[model samples]
Target: MSKDYPALTRDIAQYTGELRKLVPETMHSFYALSRAAGANGRIDAKTKELIALAIGITQRCDGCIGFHIKALHGMGASREEVAEVAAMSIYMGGGPALMYAADALRAFDQFDVPAV
Candidate 1:
């Protein structure tokens, strides 16, 4: 469903005090399907990060862009992988994806490395 993402995010965040609270509950079917996609599949976490990156780019979600970038790094995705996802997104989602993709790249560069 097409939505004004900014308004949806603000409305959810306002009610929940944080966006994460709205994640699982808001898209139950999608969440279920996502989990199912990994069941005994060859698809790896890094690939999933790319998918998430594309979704964030399409959705223009700043928080999701940052979160998925962190997820990519956690799954050992290199900068090149993140760049590839951004590149792929532009083809499908057009110019708006660039802004969100840029935020993802910036977050990847700026976020602290987790302790080993």
Candidate 2:
């Protein structure tokens, strides 16, 4: 069997809602601290998101990568941008990076941001 993403699936809405409940509070904690460190004044939001994506990949958190990539696009990151940033994770993480990057890439479609 072959697997691909950006396709229709079952049970996604439940998972999506569940993710919403957990992710917002966790993301806000980081966001609050980032702002407290004057990160709000220094780093742009998109860049921060890319940084988060990289970190998620490094940590091998499939959920983090998936959610952050979705968040990145929601913040206006493009597919090429996501692809570009995730590529660097390749050097930092090796094969695991490539694999997880694709998982993150799926967020682009799964989140209804439309493919770019």
Candidate 3:
């Protein structure tokens, strides 16, 4: 079955916000780490996002797939680029990764429309 990626990300965001309220310090630190890891150093932000998306697919995390695909879309990542990453994930992660990689591509297509 097809997934509602936008709704999935939105629901995750709402719950994440709630978690932030419950564990402010831990969540703040995690956000800080995310920012630091995602920041451009030698690699560009788009590349970093691509790598993250690939990892997400390999790990089979639906939330990661949705969020990273959304971010990649906002960063102007073409479908070709995401497809390449999906291929790489499938290569490394085998059958399970293939499943999530397809889902990642679906997420990318879902976000291809105007930003919600």
Best by TM-score: 3
How does model 2 score by TM-score?
0.64
For each candidate in turn, the TM-score is: 0.64, 0.64, 0.96
C-alpha lDDT of candidate 1 relative to the true structure: 0.69
TM-score of 1: 0.64
lDDT of 1 by residue, 5-113 (tens): 3344356547554544567566666567767863445877568768878898889887677657766666778888788888888888888888777766776775544
State the C-alpha lDDT per candidate: 0.69, 0.69, 0.94
Tell me the spans in candidate 1 whose CA falls farther than 4 Å from its real position: 1-40, 112-116
For candidate 3, list the clashing residue pairs, or say none.
Answer: none
lDDT of 3 by residue, 5-116 (tens): 9999999999999999999999999999999999999999999999999999998899999999999888989999999999999999999999999999899889887864
RMSD of each: 6.9, 5.4, 1.1
Give the poorly placed runs of model 3, Cα more than 4 Å off: none
Clashes of 2: 0
